[model samples]
Target: MFEKILPFTRKKHVAGLKCAFTGHRPQNLPFRFDETDERCLRLKAELRKLIVQMIEQKNVTHFISGMALGIDTYAAEIVLDLKSQFPFITLECAIPCETQAAKWSERYRNRYFGIVEQCDKETILQRHYSSDCMQKRNRYMVEHADLILAVWDGKPSGTGMTVTYARSLRKSVWTLDPNTFSVTVE
Candidate 1:
């Protein structure tokens, strides 16, 4: 007996503006592990607002998230949430490694997987984690994006490094201050 095979259909690519996200993990955020905190709620609101602006005003059709534990997770979720209203928008998760969430708590791991499941695409940089795997992921996103949205506190960290790298490439970087709820472009 012959077995019938179905053709693989790839997701359509919409060529347009793209944005990448970079931010501190939960350990660096003011409301670490407290999603219910007022600061966290407000930060999410602001992130959602900027995403809407990107979709509506800037016509950005694609968003890349590194899938880190804090801001990356939040940004990816925001993009997925906006997909209902802006159906054309797509989210791509740039995972540093296959086991990126292996050591996380069950709750966080579940959330990460949930977001990954809903993202339109995922790019795994490497099969295993290395010292520079995170930087590699960050560079990949920055190289592929037209703009970088960073939630930073003006301190030196991975997020700061990503911002610096993006700036070095002359890419537009919009930085959001987590403490002040203000945005600055570089």
Candidate 2:
């Protein structure tokens, strides 16, 4: 699927390394639903802390995301917030296909489009949408990233596919296991 996008060149570029994030659209609270306000606050706090650690430890100056409903959107929002402090933190929107945002609800579409507008780069995988196109997009993301941050619920889905591809590439992969409250890399 990704026969075109070349991997990052090793020429001594002054910019920081690029890190992409791929994960399932989290259906749990603070993502899809709002349970207790306190829990929501706590979860947000933890997420921010983790994101900060990734930026500091991984030297991630750029974040690439697909703008999906749950995990992708959350990661993008965190990157946007971190941009204020780390102004060089770039957000790149890697859409599976043109008009892919149309598949989402109107509100979500608007929000996602707004984020794309704020991004430093936006790449469309195909001129049209297809079931297989998302897999192609995921492959493209894994190909370009120095590291991948995956927020997973242990489901076998697109996130799993992305993780598999990243592993095959031998890229640094960090996973936030919501079940264990820990990060692990294979």
Candidate 3:
């Protein structure tokens, strides 16, 4: 149902090295929307470390986030925070639909908008949501990116599916398990 994609940022030459994010939502995370929890804080720390590693070592200049809750939100924020240090890096919000956060709580909605406003690029994949819109957005990110960064619990969920899809395309996939704080590359 995606007829057109819209970008809200001024045009710039796309970067050569890019990374895309796929992850579970808040409900599936151990902290369950409680960012103050020690577990959540630790997870964010690890996530930030991984992103920095990607930027510093791999020369990844572009990061794409699905703009979902939980890990996606964390990734976008981490990218923004690192911008002062790595001014060449850019964050792209690969939103699945125009109203992706319409049903979210007011707190989350505000957070989403704040991140979107600060992002270097905002890509709305579709004007309206569809049954497969999320998957469509995931594929869009994987297709555009050179590497896929995933936060998955090894379950048959959306994040798992995105990892599988990335592998099938022979894209480099790095997975970080939020539960054990372990990372695997494939």
Candidate 4:
């Protein structure tokens, strides 16, 4: 597996442009129910538009998603939707563990697993599960991506850690503040 690891470089490459996604798990009921309220729906639409614009402007050909709840799942959905218009677009599922899906609710678990099955590629970080291993998976995503798409609510949490790691790597990052709907490029 160590031999399979590749160094991530600053220069854009030809195989595909990869963007990793991470974000806070939505705390509100709207996200819990998997039903988009009016505000969330509007925000989701706007996010989709911004992502598509970025894909076009940056010539992104592949999107890598951790497939965690909330923002990661949403980003994958958006990229999958865009695949119709950009046939070359591919989604890679970077799952934290082999059995992580078992922790989610049946509905959500099925939905997430379905996406993983449908993705162009899926990379499971560990054969077994552990709290620390999840963190390692997040770090792996940050290390591999050329860019990061983050959804932040201006709080310190796991998503913050991801943002910090991306910054340290000097990878391009784009963020959407859930509270303000303002997009920031870092």
Candidate 5:
């Protein structure tokens, strides 16, 4: 009955409840990578608040995480923890490449793959690493999300680039400071 609706002309499925996450790796964070670190614990608490806001205030039901080491992994874990309360919320993993975590430590690699296994969906941008794969993954998240949750230090980083790209797309970005555990809309 709708054969005339061309692919490009057809209305896209715009998810009203979509959010993406971006953040710096462990080395870039101001604190040690241990979850028990005071800094890490504080950020985890704050992230729980933000995700709750997204669910209760913004009606965000779908979350996308890049699954990187430091902040991204923590954010994904928080979302997974919240799933028991917000049963409808879904997590999606956007990986840059198949071998993205090849060089990571065994523990981190296992964590990354575990999260990937639990995600509702995964989009692998490339089979192998390319200079632009990360950027491409960032762009995909920006294009798909209604909002971006970034853990940035207000410096030059891939996280910063993702935030800039989200802003350019007219997507609202909530930036979190790893140093002070503060969130600002930029």
Candidate 6:
């Protein structure tokens, strides 16, 4: 099962210019992950730069977000902010299940809805959660995207799993460190 790893250069080679995002939650952040935290702000800034590069430099027009908290939410917001400049850009929310955020605090839930409301498309995986639902969502994004922007800390988790799968599928993966804010392409 461990074969067929290919290096991807850019999204332009794919059928459509599409990309996806994955990352750790706020709790996994090295510094305070609060909205106003300096580290968090810096992370957002780095994400903004990368998103812009995807749009202007890489010719990516569509972005898929899992809609999870932390990097996922931040990435989605950055794409939305970029719409004013790249008006043709589109955001697709690929939710794992209807109750995917049911356990989140009200604050996070509100933020999630706000992002979803503005998304160009929404694909809910299932009506209820399953043991494999999140994995399925990750696969869905990887299967649809030509590239994946991953905010990871070189650790083993869902984000890492997605990155590994992306590489196996020969999709371009850009990994960003939550602590250092550096992006390395694989």
Cα lDDT computed for each candidate against the true fold: 0.89, 0.75, 0.89, 0.77, 0.82, 0.87
- The digit string of per-residue lDDT tens for model 3 on 1-186 reads 333233445445445589999999989988898999998999899899999999888899999999999899999999999987877788889989998999998999999999988887788898898999999999999998999999998988999999999999999999999899899988
- Where does candidate 1 stray beyond 4 Å? 1-14
Stretches > 4 Å off in candidate 4:
1-14, 28-34
Question: TM-score for all predictions?
Answer: 0.92, 0.84, 0.92, 0.87, 0.89, 0.90
* Cα error of candidate 2 at position 125, Å: 0.8
Would you list the rank order by TM-score, best first?
Answer: 1, 3, 6, 5, 4, 2
Residue 94: error of model 1 in Å? 0.3
Q: In angstroms, how far off is 2's CA in candidate 2?
A: 12
**Model 6 has how many clashing residue pairs?**
0
Q: Count the backbone clashes (under 3 Å) in each candidate.
A: 0, 0, 0, 0, 0, 0
For model 6, how big is the CA root-mean-square deviation? Answer: 7.2
For candidate 1, write residues 111-185 as lDDT tens digits: 999998888778888889899999999999999999999999999999999999999999999889999989997
Tens-place lDDT per residue, model 6, 39-59, is 888999999998888887888
lDDT of 2: 0.75
Q: What TM-score, to 2 decimals, does candidate 4 have? A: 0.87
Off by over 4 Å in 5: 1-15
C-alpha RMSD for every candidate: 5.2, 4.6, 2.9, 4.8, 6.5, 7.2
